[model samples]
Every structure is written in C-alpha cells, then in structure tokens.
Target: MPAPEGFAYVVRGADVVISHHGRPVTTLRGRRAAAFLDDVEREDPQELMARLTGNYRRGNERQARNHPRNRGR
Candidate 1:
C-alpha cells in the first residue's frame, strides 16, 4: 500500500524507510524489511503509550478521580 498523506516511505536498493506523521522514525534492511515497515505503520499510539507509560489516557480516570488536584472547586 502507498504511504499515508502525512507519511512517506521509500525502498532503496535493499532497505525500507518509514516515517510517522511525516517524520522519519525507522528504517529496515534485509529480507524482512517489508514486514518491519508494515508493522511500524500499523502501530497504535494508545497501545504504545500504555506499554510505555503503564496507562492509556482513557485509563487515567482512576488517578484523576482520586486526586484532589483534579477536583473541581
């Protein structure tokens, strides 16, 4: 498939380039390059954030609910 509007990709002699929202983020080389590129483009921001931060934005409700700082005056 073609790259999305805000994204771009290129297939050099033996490498695959990948970008996100238009910024270059990764490059894959060798036989599995295409698969790697596919995976990169299909990544989910929410899943990534949850993996990195231990909680997704929607899952932060508990903290906001119990924190006095977030309480309405």
Candidate 2:
C-alpha cells in the first residue's frame, strides 16, 4: 500500500535497510532478508519491525497477527 509514510529501503550487498524521513530505522539480513523487505514495503512500520526485530509498540499487536501474509511457506 504505497509503503508506510516516510518508509523506504534498499538492498545493498546483503543488508536490507529500512528508513523513515531520511533516517535509518533498522537493518535486516540473513535468509529472510528479502522477506523483511517485502514487509517493509507492505506492512505498517510498527507491525513490520515488531515481527522482524521484536521491537514492539503499543496497539500494534493486532496488526502483527493480521499481517498481510502470515505464512512463510
């Protein structure tokens, strides 16, 4: 959904960087790197980071469970 406001990223070498308002928000890598990027582009920032980085935010629990795609298969 046009990415979250101020949310943008780039996959460089092996790292997937998530940024907001030109500031670095977080970096994701490993086998699920691409998956994380998809999350960044699709899910809300709160839900995406919560699921990928374990950084939770209030009121986002529901968003996490109802994420766009909940399966890794």
Candidate 3:
C-alpha cells in the first residue's frame, strides 16, 4: 500500500514501512527497520531514555515483589 501523505516510505530489505511525527506507523523488521531505529536514535534520545526507564522500572517492580525482603510482608 502507498504511504499516507506526509509519511515517508522506508524499504528495509524487502519490506516497506512508514514513519510520521517521529513515530513509526507500524512495527517494521529487517535491515530497513534497523536503519529506521538508527534514525530514531539520532533524532530523539530523550524519548528513548524515557521508554527504556519506564520498562526497567516496571520490570523491577515485578521482580521486587518476588524478592525475599518482601516475600513475607
């Protein structure tokens, strides 16, 4: 399918993808996806850090509840 207006089509190996307003229109894979990620990295560092930190915090909370320190309380 053709990408919507204002969106750019990115071909990664054999797949086609699009991105807009700094977010990808859909999850893409392969070399093109990798390149897209690189572009995102170069464009936005704060948003990436926020996502990573949020994920880490969520996982840490799950792990903390299973730890011995909180096992009985």
Residue-wise C-alpha lDDT for candidate 2, range 9-45, written one tens digit per residue: 6788888876666778778788677777666577675
Candidate No. with top lDDT? 2
* Cα RMSDs, all models: 8.1, 10.9, 12.8
Residues 1-73 of candidate 1 have per-residue lDDT tens digits of 2212434456787886655555666666785675654665688533432333233245567788879987773
Pairs that collide, model 3: 12-32
Candidate 3 per-residue lDDT, tens place, 1-67, comes to 2222344445666554554555565545677466656766585533443332232134467688899
Count residue pairs with overlapping backbones in model 3: 1
> lDDT, candidate 3, residue 33?
61
Candidate 2 Cα misplacement greater than 4 A, ranges: 1-3, 38-73
Please tell me which model should have the higher lDDT, number 1 or number 3: 1
TM-scores for every candidate against the unseen true structure:
0.37, 0.47, 0.27
Rank by lDDT, highest first: 2, 1, 3
Tell me which of candidates 2 and 3 scores higher on lDDT: 2
